[model samples]
Target: MKLYHSVDTRSLRCVWLLEELGVSYDLDVVPFPPRVKAPEFLAVNPLGTLPYLVDGDTKMSESVAILEYLLNRYDGGELRLTPDEADYGSWLNWMHFGEASLANIQATILRYTLFLPKPQRLPVVGEDLSVFLQERLKVLDAGLQGKTYLCGERFTAADISVGYALLLSSLFGYQKYFTPAITVYFDRLQSRAAYQAARAKS
Candidate 1:
């Protein structure tokens, strides 16, 4: 298996999970916004999206989907919650929630605040996004109030999925709005050996 990734992007989620699963895979670190910085990558994936994975004949792009694929395909079932598990629904919800809800807001904020040129940057839009993000974070903070992981005591793929959004919050300077529960949860995630390894390698 091989993964095309960009440091600090959603691709880190896949790298983190791969480390936790102790799987042997190739990591191709590419420049961010690959369509511009690495035009050659466009031939491989027309979308030029990061977190692209190629495993034999299988290919994937979405970060959360790639995590599920890795778990199911690489004999990493230990980190997966089956359909019969009580927390399965919650697990799926939180996993997709991280990217669909949190990261989507973060990306928009980035576009308005940093990605665009100074003259194009919109302070009002960035501020509104920050407020919106804080409101969304409330759900995550509440969900983590009494649990070590999103689903429960076990460290599952859901944590990796959500943890990447938390990681993005910190990197993008929105962590100031992180609630107490979120702060503790992010700290726990950062302390993991696999998380550390993924960070160093990225």
Candidate 2:
């Protein structure tokens, strides 16, 4: 298995999962802004996105999908919950919650606050996204009030998925709005050895 990745991107979540699973794989580091600068990488992933992966014939792009794929294929049922598990539905919800919902808002925040030129930047838009993200985070915060991890008593890939987005949000200055629960959750995630290993790579 080989992973095409960029630092400080969602690909780090996959790398973290790989580390936690103890899987051996090659890392193909690509410079940021590859879509315009790296034609060879575009050939591998027409979307030119981070977390493009090729595992003997199974090619994938989306970071969350790649994560699920890795867990399904490599893990011995530790990082995920099966359909029989009581927390299965909640697990799936939070897994997609990070990427599909929070990430979209984060992208908008990045576009207005960082990517756009000062003349074109919209602080109001960024503020609105911050509000949106904070509102969404409330759900997670409430859910985590009594639980050690997102799904249940044990840590799972659901934590990896949601944790990655939460980590990025904090780095992007979203922590000011974080509830105490979220702050504690983020700290616990940061304390993980696998997360540290992935951070070193990032």
lDDT of each: 0.90, 0.87
State TM-scores per candidate: 0.95, 0.94
Tens digit of per-residue lDDT, candidate 2, span 1-202: 9998887788988999998998999998888878766778988898888888899989988988988898889963778988898888988888899888787789889999898889999999988888888889998899898989997678988888888888888778887878899899989999999999988884
* Model 1 per-residue lDDT tens digits across residues 127-199: 9988889888999988988888887678888889889998998997889989888998889999999999999
> What does the lDDT read for residue 162 in candidate 1?
85
To one decimal, what is the Cα RMSD in angstroms of model 2 from the true structure? 1.5
| Regions of candidate 1 where Cα sits further than 4 Å from its true position | none
Candidate 2 Cα outliers beyond 4 Å, as residue runs: 36-39
Best by lDDT: 1
- lDDT, candidate 2, equals 0.87
Candidate 2 lDDT at 109 equals 91
Give candidate 1's TM-score: 0.95
